[model samples]
Target: MPVIVLEASDFTSPLFLVRTWEVLSGCITFSLVASLEPPNPLSDLHSTFRIFCMFVWCFFFTLTLLIHILSIIQFHSLIPVSWKNLTMTTAVLGALMGLSASVVFAWMVMDHGGRLTHTVAAAVASCITFLAYSSETYVLRTQAHEQRGYMGSNPGLLKILQLWGGCNMIPLVMEVVHSQGSASGLPSKVLSWQLWVSTALYGVCVLMSLVTVVVILGDLAGRCFLPFDKCLAAFSMIGVLLYMVATVICFTKILQLKELGNRAPTGVTELIIMETVVASITLLAYTVDLAFSIKLLCDRSHA
Candidate 1:
């Protein structure tokens, strides 16, 4: 068992963490210069903007999750079609997933005093859970495909899974995820066991992140902090980015395969918004984490 500890300073407060996190994570913490706050440490420059962002993030997260169920809906033919059903499904599921990840990351940050062992274990557990979700997402899509002959068969599920979770998960199992390659060759259909480039591209990123996490944790307790946890922060944040990129590539392939073309998918923009929110939330989580790591390294160096 091991645990990562946060050494907090008297002046290093939550307000500082949140602001620094927002800035480093890419939000324009500084609002219009002509605003009325007078550039105070507690300025409310982006007050309205921040609130809007938060609302958008939560909505996107939850909607994505719910939309996961829309896979069961049908939309096509001369009677006029609306994929809104499916899009909404994705929104719902995406939201749920976003929320879960947020809770876990926030909990980790807020309870930084916990032992390194717990943090390490929790991180591993969370990753495993996500992997499981990935598998289920695949299963759901596979099942929806066309409900094959057998009692458990659902071809429709597979078809949609290939659309939703299937694409990204494939990269997880195959390439250095989050890389840029044509998404057309997904799910890594092994043609005589020869690996697909799409698979390899995404798999490498994933493998690298996994190794980074394990290596960093190996010294969790002994290392002074900053660098060790920075490794964790890097691995985790990079992994998030990897997921976003891979998922996009996967979606493109699915769309192409389905001949979705330029017309925007019903909820694609919403899904993107949701993913962006998750990215922001993730940024906050890791910023708090590695920032503390930075503080620790600085303190130790001065000592």
Candidate 2:
């Protein structure tokens, strides 16, 4: 029979406290948002944004609770992943998603006139939840040097940022594609190729980051035939080139739409603009990762 042990110290840890705040604030956010009655009928984009925020809150709440329970029971070892890496990944992802959700929910409420007390409260709670998650990320990051996991390192954290940026680009790109013809008064086919290329680039970024994170967390980097560090550098270089192409495509398309007198619905133009910004930021992150990878390689060669 296997013995089950409880670690009281885990409950007192800063990470645990941060997670507790995340759970509570997340609960408050969703609860308040659920009670809100939109003063006016919401557009598809607005409704989607609201639902996304609620989903983020609910999903993180459940995930944080489960993590806490596993820690309390000291059963995290049963999972094949590095516990530190898992927590760090969760913290980074949760912080990004929470911040995005908070911004979206707050924007939606304000756009709807911001008169409802519950809606405003929900937005505030969402911000608090974002802060909690951010704090958790900071705490985890500060302890990264103490852990052997790759996720505790700078490049590993940047990979999470790249992943988040890629995820953000996908939906925004999709919305841009869906609204292309109607928004710019041009045929969808006119920009179809460009949009599809952007989508493919974003998808590739997400796929690469996800694969890298999985390899690190699963401790499979060493078993790979190719040197993991070199592979990561190659991927980062590819990501940079792809994102550069994506950025140019995005901006050029946006300029063309503007020149054509954009007729995009409330949030469609914003979505396009947001996609461009995310692509640029993701590019910057990839550039930094490439630099870090090079530095690591140089250091190893010197040794």
Candidate 3:
């Protein structure tokens, strides 16, 4: 007779593997799209942005692959757990990958508004990656802190996650509403202003995410070195609050200004639907994570 053994940790290992693989898969898929486009189709600046985006995606692909390999070994107990720095390092790398992608997306949008399929899709995908990475990094930090008993970890962070999730969700909803309202053709003035506003709001979202990364890093090592995590967290929430307000204003204005001259083109309708799907997935990920974090926080408080 043989005896089988399992640890509590084993239950969650598969989730990490799946999450990491999703990031890698997304990177590869988008990189292929960005790379296959004809060179110099736009201008020198546009060409350079595409090249940079391709490189960034490939970098994340390789990095996540390495992380996945190590994680599998770690989960099986084939490797020692003494490497406390590994997850933190990976988290920082993930953040950097996200930031790089965000910059490239912003550049593309500036060069050619989000009307372009490549630009819009890449922008949406990059934002999803940023949220995914940020959430995972937070989880890693929370696990480390809980193990060491160095911090009462989850509640504060969970608050941030919940807020972040809700706030980020508003813009995506607004985007979908705006898309539907403009199912007809868009006037040039309306299109131009919409593009600029969307770009600017994206910049704010990026900054909010970056601050969350900073807060996590500041606390992860059990150091109060930054001493300003709370302040930054407040600002992050404020940023999202403003985003929510802006989204409402934008949505209303889009409806008011939309032209009814022609029905939406099939391609345009399909693209908007695809983007909405992507946004929905991201929103669901954040919401689920937020709920899980809340449960963990409650369990810890009771314990």
Q: lDDT per residue, candidate 1, 1-303, as tens digits?
A: 233333456226442332233222211111221121333322422243233324433443343333322221211211222233233233223334433443433333344333343334433443343343344344434444332211122222222222233222342322222211223343434432433654554465446434433332232324445454455446445544655564565455455535654553432333333333433443343344445445656787899
* Predicted candidate 3 versus true structure: per-residue lDDT over 1-303, tens digit per residue: 233444567647744754575465557447635654544223433334455556656666676666666555554244333333344444444554565567545654665434556655666677666666666566666564644221224433433343333333334444444554466466857766765666565556556555555445344424546534444444545554554555455444444444532444422343344333433433443444445545655676699
lDDT of 1: 0.36
Q: Which one is best on TM-score?
A: 2
Error of 2 at 38 (Å): 7.2
Q: Give the least accurate 10-residue stretch of model 1, judged by summed lDDT.
A: 25-34
User: Could you tell me which residue pairs clash in candidate 2?
Assistant: none
Q: Distance (Å) between predicted and true CA of 28, model 3?
A: 6.3
- Model 2 global lDDT (CA atoms, 0 to 1): 0.79
Please name the candidate that would achieve the greatest lDDT relative to the true structure: 2
Cα lDDT of all candidates, in order? 0.36, 0.79, 0.50
For candidate 1, the TM-score is: 0.26
All candidates in order of TM-score, best leading:
2, 3, 1
